[model samples]
Target chain A: MPDKSLRMRRAGGDGLVTRPVMLAIAGDSAAGKTTMTRGLVEALGPDRCVSLCTDDYHRYDREERKELPFTALHPDCNHLDIMEQHLQLLATGNPVLKPVYDHATGELVRPELVEPAEFVIVEGLFPLWSKLSRACFDVTVFLDPPEEIRRGWKVARDTSKRGYTQEKVLAELERREEESAAYIRPQRQNADLVVRFAPIEGRDDPAGTSLSASLMMRPTIDHPDLTDVLQSGLSRAMHLKLERDPDGRPVETLHVHGYVPREESLGVEKAIWSALGAPDTETPECLGRLGDARSEPLAIAQLLLLYHLTDAAR
Target chain B: MPDKSLRMRRAGGDGLVTRPVMLAIAGDSAAGKTTMTRGLVEALGPDRCVSLCTDDYHRYDREERKELPFTALHPDCNHLDIMEQHLQLLATGNPVLKPVYDHATGELVRPELVEPAEFVIVEGLFPLWSKLSRACFDVTVFLDPPEEIRRGWKVARDTSKRGYTQEKVLAELERREEESAAYIRPQRQNADLVVRFAPIEGRDDPAGTSLSASLMMRPTIDHPDLTDVLQSGLSRAMHLKLERDPDGRPVETLHVHGYVPREESLGVEKAIWSALGAPDTETPECLGRLGDARSEPLAIAQLLLLYHLTDAAR
Candidate 1:
């Protein structure tokens, strides 16, 4: 909420964070992480944020992997220790030569230089699996959509975008389910926040195809003022749906309908702010944050969390 | 032979023996293939002889080979198809980017350009083993030295030239022996000539260690005149040590002892050449077929034989 360095200076001691703030976006293949990430990144602009993918850590290319006993999804199939070391280097405000994975030929080609920025988002399925690498991240979010939605998304995305046929995508999804459960799904329970973007079932308005999203923020961590998040008006047509998280844990859900009116979404955003103790200043103290115009509320929420993560470390 | 080319030209035919020749030099590791190749090349000059090594075909470095099931000596551990293709290309007067094997580090550092010349000396352990490749060589020689001599040479070369310890050198030699036996030694039996250089086993010469050499020539097919070989003073010192080959094939063996005097070695070379018929030009009606020093006996025997082999098919 304040100049982090100045905040510490005013607090009368030099105790401050030194490492750059990092976030890990862990999700299954075709689980809406990239779509959500692209939208949020576009809204935030590029100067203050940078992104890296975990696929570059794979030791062998697709063709090479066919000869190996383990599939690419297994941790041993990647140079995880090397990846971990690179993440630590980036967290300390440096850079690394990231290996290139050519999706067209499914080969590992030349490496490219990846420079670190103030906010780093490392996105991949196994990003949170290695504890040593996880130590570099300040904010960790896991995307968990229902299996039916995930499968549908995977089929559509793989067929349309990855040069796969519908049958092949579906068959691959079925085959991967066991490994997905064994390795990927368990990571959701450990995230600082869990995000899900899907239509709330059983809701059939005359308008049809209602969609909703919820950000489950854990307590005992620094919370952000929602004044900036409300500016993008993402929750305007949505409802701040809350209920006991099945395991007796506290959880809040935002449920939006596809055909909901725009003004209603704005109203939902306002409710979210009122719920988070939106900053009381007349104009708002968040700049460089959520910005003035071009963005969405969900994006602003993501940035606000990143600010807290890096600022708290300082 | 008379000028058959002149008679053929008059009869509307060609008798210049316009075929590519194959020359193979097989030897154990560090047994002087590279050294002898350097000497032959210098003497013949670049225009007449081109030397290439099979070491360039290795698929992995030494460190990587330790993890592999087979040793580098195995054909599967090399890009043999590419090598055979390159060899065929070179035999047809084409150039190839022959890969370089850094013997010191046991790595393929880079590919070197090797253009076809008049004589192509293919030197390596398994050069003669490939049936398809043998059709390309015109002459083949195997370098044979005693086991103790080879070990001493390897120890000295690996320590001083390759930067290896005597212990490591010995261990590597032992590790490669099985693969060598299964892959390299059989090629020796296919050689046209076996040249062995070693000290006389029991003789003690007071002056110096005058090691003898034996050049076992099986020129059952067309070969350059031995008269030229005798004229050069190598024939007299070569005692005809006849023996049946291991396969029970009858053959003539020419032996030169370590204790032989220099003058006698020269005398022996002359006696063999005189016996072969180089001085047959003494008649009044017969002008010598070779009128220039360029066609000298030693040059014709060594370099021309190389030329015949490499140009046999082409």
Candidate 2:
């Protein structure tokens, strides 16, 4: 409990060779992190990867906290130290007993045992907030979207599945904004990639029909091998380029078109796998490279990084 | 919490006519209380009946308690007084913010606001253990399925739903016997009715596919006017008889056969409704009787008794 951030950093830096890969999917409420994570988990299978949400560590059961001054989204309202410990444990391949929170009811549910896998994706707001929690991850992604887009997504999801009335959804969103700004927004600066999907820029972008994205990749890490990935799968409209953010850090940006051929994505995967020098074995497909939009490419790129780090461990 | 039982008895003896009625279904672990209660709830409709699990108030999350001497089922391992407060709140029209428990992972999940309904059913091991809780119940039931039947039900349920191995279930069952006896079994004497379902007395009477049920009813609560019910349609095999335990307390027993047709149940319902003399309007079909092989007559008897108790209070 002595400042979890300090412990996480200490645990992370001590005897670290090629640091074990850590990734975070930071997003506002329901911006598709769960959907994307589901696909990733399906592709990688749960054995090689485990995903956890930072919301589990809320400090109070919903009712008791209602009397508190601050809402649950605030830092003081969570067991940040305990969450950091579990993250560290997971990153180190040890099992951690994590707390449970019921989203629909706004209460702390039960604790669940989470065994570590090769990759752990920590998803939620403020996941990248504390230096300790951030120290535990080697790669972090932030999801950003326009207000109206996020709100629309929230409305449809909550009403149909969660029994929420329109008024409750809007009220909750309004109440959470202050905490989101103070605690969740700052975490984006620490992320390796920031993915944003919104109506396309600079045109007659129909309300919700178009999509565009921006990715911010930290320069400290080695880039993925993307030679064959670039040659196939991606339509001519899909391309990658480098740009410097306002902070002056270089970013690798991938632009994906609204409509891309499926085979091209498959071909891109094959190319990236071949670049990994593993000789295009079917074993990787079974290992879970089957669904990445650029699954083959991302699989090879991700696996190459993993192989390098694990090999360096020995 | 000024002794919840004291509060309830005050509501009764002091002539508080407006308070919502509270009913409890008490039993040992794996008893048929959940199934029976589910039937009642579904039949009554969730709006009319609100049910809370005292089991949800465990003091420790599942993993932490694994190393502790007391299991989750032990009284000392839960926050009982808090549970009493919630029950008292629920017994009124007020809402109780109750704790959430995750059944799959055996952890405390979150809390939810449980609004009081017309009839509240508190179902769990210690529902009737404390005198404070006993005072709140307008009617109490103890489901005492034979040990063998309970064990069979438990093993099947735990293995299928809880991720427990057969050996683990058996071992846990063995471990719980002492605590169950000490903390749970004594509640039977305090209950208004004890419903037992087991293999009917004859092993060779193969067509005796019905489970025998004994309703140990305490007949002193002045019975309701069942004239309307008796006149409406209660003559179908639904007959009442008086029974006595070895200890000599008068017990009103009602027996319904497994093969009793549905129409006969409607008749029993109409008679009970007529007896209440509350309203002459049609009683909805959904309000039909909850049968436990022989509970039709016993329920009619129980309702008549409840009606008179309310009238006496007024």
Candidate 3:
């Protein structure tokens, strides 16, 4: 009801909700922020779901950032105030002149105008790091993949795409680890859903098995009913359990096995499609793709975020 | 490769295998067999998936069956040998003239011709009752919902659909309990997967919460990797544990909690879909519905069977 009330305040006076519902997906670099948002944008349709990166708020370009004492992960290295202002504008369904940060060139390009669509997904390191930034979105998510895995992903991505050597990437990761611990990780506490994709702790699965995923579902928002999909008694690839978070709060944790066959993951996908009111006639084909490869965990996580984005609009 | 060999044997020597993969869904009356199979048919497409009820093998009409000393569940009351032969015929992609027992009119109608499609799902009390029948399927599933829930579902269905009063249904249930225990229940042991749908043992969820389900993944056949789903930290609605069955064999039991939101179930479903090779463009819309009411457990059970049916074809 309160959520509806908030929606009312943000709507146009003509009794139609022209305001775009906002979602914030925040995480550290190489923490799967972009990968997560990519599927969401595809699933929701790029025309309807406007996506942006909060890293664009960087006051200093990559070259300039090197002179700073703090790493990019630190609050001092970024323009939190400007990011928050842009979020507020987007939340009210207003357009903003958003800056761009090119990862490949490490350059801050000229600002470009962006109009709010039916839904807006903002992904970056500090989207939920401040109260003002957090309040601008109806739903928030944080990626918390294991540090080692993140490091590996970061190294591989940077060396291949960003023109960095593996050694440079690893060293940069080590340098940024401290700031990440202080600034990026804490944002997870504010998220409605904390997603972690990692390998299972004990199993020595034969080669070609994908990593498993664990999501901490905090009661910050109403989620889709997953009991049916998990309990369908037909799949062994997924499960859910009520557990306690680090803050001692009771939360539900959903674990999705990646090594399972693709059909098992599709079961959960259909459940989501129905929960999302069967948004399209079919599940978005663009989902589950990471570069040329496919990742089911990423797709499911994006679908959950998509559910919230659309559910809030309704 | 061996499975392919069997396929070759079934084909008409063209080297292009055409044998339909078989799946057996065996359960007692009102065990959610039809409800479960309905989704598979829809998900796989009616053109590709053929479904048959082995109960149609009843030697006598329902009215005449009432006069017999043995219940319909008893081996003597049905043409189980004929059913076994038919199963073998279907398994090898052959056609069969199958008997039809019309539940609506309580009569033995004319036999119908059945040609196996890409997939065949056989549901009834005795489909897996005999070893010969069990060997006819590439995969087998047993529905073992709680007696109380089954009784409630049966009463609701028989009174509303069949020409039976609640009292008569109850009496019939009591009369058939012995036969169900002796003849129907034992068939569960022969199944590769045992699905039990029921409420959580302790909690009293308010109305509208669906029933939970527990699936016993027996090691009779290799299952897709589900560890990724069980280990994914996102959901609390589902869980997996290695436990001992009544026969003392170690099995993996997956429990899906019904109280979690639909989102949690979607996570698990996507994991399964990924495991199943992301069959189709979407999750089957026909799954999880039972007489206008949707049951997540039923949908999931159906999805799992669909996985087997499709997986065998691959």
Best by lDDT: 3
Interface RMSD of each: 36.0, 23.2, 35.0
| Superposed model 3: Cα runs more than 4 Å off | A1-314, B1-17, B203-207
CA lDDT for candidate 3: 0.78
Among all windows of ten consecutive residues in candidate 2 chain A, which has the lowest summed lDDT? A11-20
lDDT at B210, model 2: 48
- lDDT by residue (tens digit), candidate 2, A1-314: 12322332343322332223457788888775665455555555678677888887777877888799787778888877556645654554545556778877766655555666766667886677766566566667777777788888888888877778999889878998898788876776787666666544653245533454444456655545564467554556445667876677777765544333445544544554455466546324432232343332233233433443333233
State which candidate, 1 or 2, has the greater TM-score. Answer: 2
Q: Higher lDDT: candidate 1 or 3?
A: 3
TM (B chain), model 2: 0.76
User: What range of 10 consecutive residues in model 1 chain A has the weakest lDDT sum?
Assistant: A281-290
DockQ versus reference, model 1: 0.01
Candidate with better TM-score, 2 vs 3: 3
The TM-score values for the models, in the order shown, are 0.43, 0.46, 0.47
> iRMS of candidate 2, one decimal?
23.2
Q: How accurate is candidate 2 locally (lDDT)?
A: 0.61
TM-score of 2: 0.46
lDDT of 2 at A15: 32
Ranking by DockQ: 2, 1, 3
- Sort candidate 1 into its docking category: incorrect
